[model samples]
Target: MNDSLPGYAERLDALHQALAADFRAIIARLPWREHESILDPGCGDGFFTGLLAERLPRGVAVGLDTSTAFLEAAEARLAEQIEAGRVRLVEGNVDRLPFDDATIDGVFSAHSMQSYPDLPHALREFRRVLRAGSTLAILETDNVHSIMLSWPPDLELAVRQAEHREIGDEDSYIGTYFPRFAPRLLAEAGFTDLQREYIFIERQPPVGEALERYVELYLKYLAEQTSGRLDAAATARLAEIGDPRSKRFLPRQANFFFGSLQTLITARA
Candidate 1:
């Protein structure tokens, strides 16, 4: 777990609890079965990995990530299960997963793959480590499209400016993040029986501690994105956007494209 991610972890935990029922409803439609070993790539802080371990059959869950901070946090959260030998955690990058070829039954990632510098290389690695008939599920935010749709005009401009100032590449992190044509990627990776689905998760306004944490995370993200070059004006504008008392309420709904999260049912020739 990166020290940077714990705050986001707290926010997501709040999200999981608040939306547990809805999340379960969505998971119910996923094709999971008993005793199938699953790999959670980029298993940040182990939240989703713990969820899968609890839901899937016993003794068949593994979490792999690059952040030592996250792996430590994940181990702590799943300590009891680890003691019982029901879960395993490994720290490694997705582009060079530390696993044997054709070993895993399935793979799952959420809101993490977009950070990879080389998407195609990482996708190829995903295809490499899975068994011939294994599956891979990826969950990522369509930040480009989603932000444009949901953010206030002023806030959106700030985000764009911040992007330009920082990366000099508008799509640096989010370019091709969602895999709009997931089947094409799967096909390129030699996957078959490809199916994709889009799920819209409506996030209500954050409240109390959760809201505070959310605002902080947003600010921190902007600060990092701008490399602290975010001027006083941009900082002030972001504060306004996050002000709980402001009339411009945060968008009540966030459309999270789930196709990337649900693709790759099995490998192919």
Candidate 2:
């Protein structure tokens, strides 16, 4: 967790609530069997980790993350499953998994790869921990079509270009470029049977409370990330859209709608 982002946990929980349905849909797409051990890397609040446990009646779901705060929250959220031995939470990093080799039957990660400093190393670790023919599924943001705020084309482009330069292109938009590069990366890491799927979630007014809060917080986070990089007018516009008190608050607009695209890539180890 970034110390600067005080609301990181809150934002993650809100996002889980808002995208619950879409996330469940993506989980359903994973090739899970009833009695197979599954690993969920970067299982932030254990939202999807609990879901994965439910899918495996006899098997266990191991949720791993580097953040102790996140692991603590996951522990509480998944206490029942943990007590039942259906779930376990571990504090660890993706690039260096703690599990033994060829143990996990399947691995599922959601929107977590972008944070990793060395994605190739993490992918190799994922491959190392999986048994032969096990499946690995990852969900990443498609920044190009994600969080469309209805901004003018030029301003949007300018903001993106500036943000990319400010935060390195790979770190800023890994999801947008994943499809183009993931195939080779996975192949080199000893994964095969590569597949890709796109998941879309859109909301129109009157949006639910969860979606409304999610959009507001997400915009604010983006605004903060691209803070001094934008021109004065663009900065003010971003602040206004993210500010719930402002008349131009995006979610409250009469025609307000939100859409997101996430890419799900799966491979066999």
lDDT (0 to 1) per candidate: 0.63, 0.82
By lDDT, the best candidate is 2
By TM-score, how accurate is candidate 1? 0.74
Candidate 2 per-residue lDDT, tens place, 159-232, comes to 78766674456555553466667898899989999998877778778877887788788777877888888899
In angstroms, how far off is 260's CA in candidate 1? 14
| lDDT per residue as tens, model 1, 149-256 | 345566667667766653445346433445564566667767787655656654444334544445445545655676555677766666555555655434322431
Residue 47, candidate 2: how far off, in angstroms?
1.9
What ranges in model 1 sit over 4 Å off?
A: 1-24, 146-152, 161-176, 205-208, 223-235, 243-269
Where is the poorest 10-residue window by lDDT in model 2?
A: 1-10
The lDDT of model 1 is: 0.63
- Best candidate per TM-score, number? 2
